[model samples]
Target: MPTKTDEERVPNFGYAGFRLDAPDASVAWNLQRGRSGQNATGDALPHNPTAQTPRRGAPPPPLRVSNPKVLNYLDDRCRVHKETINLCKSVLQRKSIDWISVQRNDMSNPIHDVDLVISVGGDGTLLRASHFLNSSIPVLGVNSDPTCPDEVDELTDEFDARRSTGHLCAATAANFEQILDATLDGSRQPSELSRISVKLNGLQLPTYALNDILVSHPCPASVSRFSFRKRSNTGESSHLINCRSSGLRVATPAGSTAAMLSAGGFVMPISSHELQYMIREPISPRDADKPLLHGLVKQGQHILVVWYNEEGAVYFDGSHVMHSIQHGDTLEISSDAPILKVILPENLLKQGS
Candidate 1:
């Protein structure tokens, strides 16, 4: 007899885009590498014999990109790409599994027929790839730099400091092969990461955000006014909350650890089905201004926000892809979409516990 968990496991042998590598400086390198003949390579790099590694029975230290930029950012990331590709090839060759790979810039709908989707880069790459997927296909994220330890002593003005560290990534290049094998063989379980669906004035938006959705004033440092109301389980709604703040963020559980956390919101469990909204810098000093600063929306409940400002914008998952909101425009956000099945390692589950 099969166990209850075993009955729920669905194995998808085919995979797509399993090796997109990115670092804090990948964006800069991608733009200028072709012009400068700069190449990122991981070969000839020395191993950190002293630093304890993961899955080899050694506990990993606090993995922090303190400076936001890692050592030899571009070259190291290139090395990560090289190692990741090699590892991916080796795993597929060993298991006789065929896989398809795509570049980070490809925007076409190419993975509709594929069952499994893999993102090889950091969190940005994962978000970019998810835009093309809307079905129930499971996604696995592989962190390119797992045990990378490089220190840059001096900061330069010309070098870009923005880092693309994969804080939400579950597997590293060193252990992705093993994780992939378990997922293929129906040994590893998948977790449902719910996504937030957005609507623009009664019209459905094309893409949903796996992370948080940001609504803000078009001009920076301007006040954003909006009125929001939530429909209850019985289809009843309380009085509308007139909000004055810098912006608003409606985030899913998977996005709790990102901008929501930095803004002092609660860190929700990745598997939670509820959605949370935080009013950023709520602007009111009066006692009567006791608005609902932050709260959670149940799975079936829907929250509608109406823009009161003439210049307002909506960004999905912090991407440049956006839709403008004008005065009296309504945006409805809900957690009614199908869950995103993300392949997580056993160790991640243990840590969460």
Candidate 2:
């Protein structure tokens, strides 16, 4: 029998909490609509700038109904999320394990020293943690609020929408202890998922995307303009093609089933190293031949995009972290990024297999 390597052991644990656990998050969420009502001038402004402005003396519009049932449902979800974290903590305490906890927003805290990272939320939590990890560390996602089977038949769509899908999470509060024990005892092996590397103006970005990157205008309503070309592994180059669209997305195989799939991109196998690209809502001249709107970027190949929009931005793993792209800035996406080691559930592993 072979001995377990250091990578296979879980000596130190790093736990990551999600948004709802952050300080004042619930309060902010409750006040979000009120905050958006008026600017500093106290004038009632239309939610859409283009909409007709109300008279200065007119009474403010009636507040939308604060659905009590929906509010209770959301509150219960938050409670479940917090309780799940508490349960995990209790287990760690009972076992006398060494661990450290950090909020998802706390990027300054170093989590690299841990042998295994645990995300106590949904896929979003795991994705955020992945930004801070290297290929050496393995991460386990714990779904804090998984939907119950009974709720599916009884709950309304609005209530159902509040539950965490936990697509990337292998464990929920119900099975966390068992899964963690198996992981610590080396009974489970981690899966290596490829990531997407990005470069801006020839300099590599500090953050690698475990999911996908969205490049678009700063304003969602504005069109995105850019020119892209592919450089193959053999040094062959494709002609630069211009595009006008809502945005462009480059996704890893791990991310292909996400926004890429929703955007009409094919879902690649989880083990694939290739990256997929898709242009969103492209605009073509009348009778003009359609340019390369979507394609795969194989390993060792790179895609270079030159920004043509005056104010554009690149979003990583969602809308959380973004960087401005000035006109003429060059953005490059490649498969040369580091791989992420993830502990998938038995079902997910079987699916990937």
Candidate 3:
């Protein structure tokens, strides 16, 4: 609390009484709690990309402790547990791990970084591994179904339409599974949302997720047209909203409290807030169930977005493979990564232990 008008600066190389103030509060978004905030608690990531190519001079020491791989992105949709894949591959072959082979058909060859990604399946295979490892990487789902529609569910014996609603939240985050068993027993700790970069078309997609970022319209119901954007402290906003009905969302805060709280949208909790991922519009389940008519869009807000699509498909986590958005393309979304490096399973944090 210092002042001369309070002084302001953030330039680095050293440090100095840095300062900033002028924001009181306006960050409560829920487009369905923005895609369920990435189940077991903590999803929606991607704003921490500043270490890309810096260091023409010096600075290099702490970067060699890597070894994590047992990713099984649904291996033909589901069925993993040969003793948990040989005890997580014997701890990555005695800690010399290097995995990759959970193919839908293996086009495989698109990884930027990885230190931990052992998703087995369910919760849409961990949002297709946070839509293809955007904030570099950090994942561990392992719920080959034992009731795992939520929280490593273990009731599976067979029969599905999408059963296993005894959730702790995986796909829909149905409930947050006691914070995913306190984040695998480290005791509740998923609050790392702030890294996001999906400005499709002019290409700024340095992706990262926790659960929420979709733009569908492969119409089985129709009403698909799109647009809606906002950037603030109190400055940029755009619009053209239409989304022919039931398909359009952008969520984070571990997904606005889970699929934005089941598509009614709004459930932000896990603090420090300033959410983005609310360019919503979902109207064509003929018109009223519209938002789940699969969540469509088009309301307006743009510095760029010339979209025109002939029909839906902008997935990112249904299993990363984006390359089908037309009419002039531009789908930029922003919130940016801060920090998230989790490896839970010590006690999943602990509060009911």
Candidate 4:
């Protein structure tokens, strides 16, 4: 049952770079059925998903899986090593199961639980996998890159993998659970969850992030009129920063070192450390002729972030997307979820690939 809309919406079919090409249509139908929830307009648009559900719940069912297969559809026809695929096939075959290579839009697999999800790429691949698996399933991250420095590689590997080494290792989704446990245990002392604040129209969000949450401006490299309430004066909420760059970003302890760092934002430790908002390449009005900020929003306490472009999109974590952010709309966003646990290698070297 989908929400009523001007035009009929058929579950979540492929919009941009994803779609279900499973063995049959049942997977698509079930996925549509599962996601057939309400949309932003209160109108029930089946297949439309709301932001992250934040009330603490019980642990998700354990994933039933066989050895993992690695694929890099981006590299050659596939980037996954032929050997890894064979390994997964061998293990799955032993269990009378056939391993299907994961596609970009395999999110509609309809399988409730997977025993394990092993990534053979970098952090980016893990991020995308997290989205496809939803927050319920855990993943084992395997770094296949060899050129990375020792210190950086240690966090993602589990086996004794060599640099650019062809080693197989593991890291669990335990980190996310630890962060959640700490949050519930009243140990915000060294919290890893990131606070996400998104203001859409008049909707200011109090969200959390397990990965990175970013705002993509409609215009490229253009300054925009964004407003926010600094943590200092809680009651007095009249502080706005006409940032000169494209957009603002709020990263979790896990993602703080990612895009946030690339944009010159500080990198907070993955589990502790407080790294607030990282503002990037902002425009200065002193040169009004250039009008760094396309426009500004000075409404009530409600922070309004506007994107005035033909097509603007926002990337949550590295997986989800909301493509309709526009003018007259306020986006108040911050991290809303805890860090997603990704298995780390025990040896932090060539053993874990």
User: For this target, which candidate reaches the highest lDDT against the unseen true structure?
Assistant: 2
How do the residues 62-177 of candidate 2 rate in per-residue lDDT, one tens digit apiece?
A: 54434555445554665565577668767776774665433344454334556777777777778877887889878888887776777766765534433566777888889989
lDDT of 4 by residue, 1-353 (tens): 12322123222211111111112211111111112243211234434255454457754222222212111111221222322333333433454332344444445333344544545444545455545453444445434333345643673443222222212224222232343233225542221233333555655433334556666665655554444333222345433444546665656555655676676656454444243455455555345323322222212222335554444556576435444565555565433333444444434222222
Kindly indicate the candidate among 1 and 4 with the higher TM-score.
1
For candidate 2, what is the TM-score?
0.80
List per-prediction Cα lDDT, in the order shown.
0.65, 0.72, 0.39, 0.39
TM-score of each: 0.74, 0.80, 0.25, 0.50
lDDT of 3 at 144: 36
Model 2 residue 105 lDDT? 46
* Cα deviation of 298, candidate 2, in Å: 0.6
**Rank by lDDT (best first):** 2, 1, 4, 3
What residue pairs are clashing in model 2? none
Clash number for every model? 5, 0, 88, 64
Question: Which is the better candidate, 1 or 2, if ranked by TM-score?
Answer: 2
| Segments in model 1 whose C-alpha atoms lie over 4 Å from true places | 1-73, 147-164, 285-291, 351-353
Q: Write the per-residue lDDT of candidate 3 for residues 86-193, one digit (tens) a residue.
A: 343344345333443333222234445444454432444444444544443445444433343542343223222132221222211222234333444565444344
Task: Provide the global lDDT of candidate 1 against the true structure.
Answer: 0.65
